[model samples]
Target: MNIKITGTGSYIPNEIQKNEDFNNHQFFNENGSKIEYSNDVIINKFKKITGIEERRYASAQQNTSDLAFLSAQKAIDNANIDPETLDYIIVAHNFGDVDMNTSQADTVPSLAARVKHKLKIENPYCVAYDLLFGCPGWIEGVIHAQSFIKSNMAKRCLVIGAETLSRVVDKHDRDSMIYSDGAGASIIETTKDTGGIISTISASYTLDESNFLFFGKTYNKASNDEKKYIKMHGRKIYEFALNYVPKAMKACLDRTRFDISDVKKILIHQANEKMDEAIVNRFYGLYNEEVPEGIMPMSIQKLGNSSVATIPTLYDLILKQKIDNHQIHKGDILLFASVGAGMNINAFLYQF
Candidate 1:
């Protein structure tokens, strides 16, 4: 038996936050000093590096779990499967249900439990839970599903990646522009089909890279509030990803004994466009081959980085023909890779 993704779905928010919207806002450095550059200069430099001119934000009424539920519902419908038959409901996210007005994350009944409740899966045996593996959480959730199915613990599983980063962002920091909100989900199950998951690789670098991304106070040092917000060492993350992500992808592809040319598409986390391009270039260089044109599809240009939701969202969009010039066909080899907080990295090879 092989494990395969039977259905995919995603919920792109309706609210659009453009870069020009931040022009009036004040941005500050982490050192408590005001940024010297004009807003246009800062945003222009940001676009040049990250390729994000706009991003989606969840409406005030929506929480992380709500986004997960919406995406999960679409996946279930797309699969045309009964919710009761699902053996597992795994929700992957960093921040839980963050309210619109506060930074406190509500994870009391786990996001998975909340999603299962929202899905109304009355079967108590469905075993709903949540996974927090940083931006790679969704991929990690799928990996866990594969493990459970292979171990006879589950037959059909629903993996969802969702986040409300806009709610947790520090408005005073320029890095806040990199965050948005969205969710994506997929139904994975055992199948008699020929192509499925071929190989997977995962690693965590915590000795010195642990705090590359973390929760910290806002950049405005004048604020005496004790509330913390999402923060990261952007340069550190870029350098770390460049050094490690390519090797992880190559290692995953190598395990399948497939040539680099066989990879039809790469769905990487939409962290930064230039960084992703460099990583893919180095990945191809490992095999002494030039990067193929259009081999990687991106949603970051409009979606920004929705943390764990990035890869799955990109995959869902491509599969649904929502992303132009990118399509997935049967017998095509695909690589999925991600790197994020926890200083974690993971990659998996899948054949469609």
Candidate 2:
């Protein structure tokens, strides 16, 4: 069964946080005590480590579901598909707008119900929900939608990746510098269409259990969990990317029976530049230097880390910025891979 994406869309918060913003605030609290730290210290540390100068963040009023809804609506309209006909809707990521509901509860049902009210398809097979291993959730969602459509279980499915990292960010901690907020959407159908999800490959390293890098949310909300900040094991993730990326790339290439040279572009997981450079250097040693010229790494030195949204966000940016100059022809191979919070990793070779 061939699954294809009919349309794509994305959304970021309206608010932008600059380096100076951090310079003005302290990221932690002493729980009825006192502390000495400001955003300036964190900002400088972020520059030294990730090289990011600014990032966008959702406001207290906004949530992940809002971003998902915005992007999903655009993708649905762009596809020219009626929401009433949609058989499934997949919500990825760990955040949402509604505070009391599950991510999907706050997300899928609300979006689908809105569509029903607007598009008139009050019922479409079923409104199923579950979590993907994340990092890999969007691809997994596309594949799942394809299976459903092919099986006659549904006709259309919308997959979303949304995160309010800022909501969970421990501003007092330097590790929080690695996360931001955003969302993305993709419309998938069970057809041999010109654009959509293609083959996907996932692999992991069990030996490096310590490479979890960092935990996303703490039960105590950072103030109690090591100063309420995101603590990242940078060197560990960096090393893991260097050692695992090449092997993972080879595995995907092998699965598709395509050589590395056959790939036109590689949309790598937005690892920081240092990690990218080191991994690419190691990639050359393991294989040839044919990883393509414009390897899309979304860590643009200032966007911070957007978790799941980074991959598709980069794809959208590339589409908008370079499509006129470098037209994406039929069957152009677009390779994508991402390594996220749980030590999860995935590679999807998309044919546009």
Best-fitting candidate, scored by TM-score: 1
- List lDDT for all candidates, in order: 0.95, 0.63
Task: Specify the highest-lDDT model's number.
Answer: 1
Clashing pairs in 1: 331-352
Q: How would you encode candidate 1's per-residue C-alpha lDDT over 1-352 as one tens digit per residue?
A: 8999999999999999999999998999999899999999999999999999899999999999999999999999998999999999999999999999799999999999999998888999999999999999999999999999999999999999999999988889999999999999999999999899999999999999999999999888888867899999999999999999999999898887798989999999999999999999999988899999999999999999999999989999998999999999999999999999999999999999
lDDT of candidate 1 at residue 144, scale 0 to 100: 97
Ten consecutive residues with minimal summed lDDT in candidate 2?
96-105
The TM-score of predicted model 2 comes to 0.80
After superposition, which runs of candidate 1 have C-alpha atoms over 4 Å from their true positions? none
> Please, what are the lDDT tens digits per residue for candidate 2 over residues 1-352?
4677777877767787777766655454324222454556656766766667777787777666677778777788878887767777777674444342122224455543443343345664647464445465665566577667778887788887767777655555555666778777878876656645556777655566443654444323434544232346676777777778767766776787666666777766554756665665566556656445565445445556677676666666566563334445578787777776566667777778
TM-score of each: 0.99, 0.80
Error of 1 at 266 (Å): 0.4
Q: In model 2, where do residues sit more than 4 Å from their true spots? A: 25-45, 96-121, 149-152, 194-198, 204-230, 297-299, 322-327
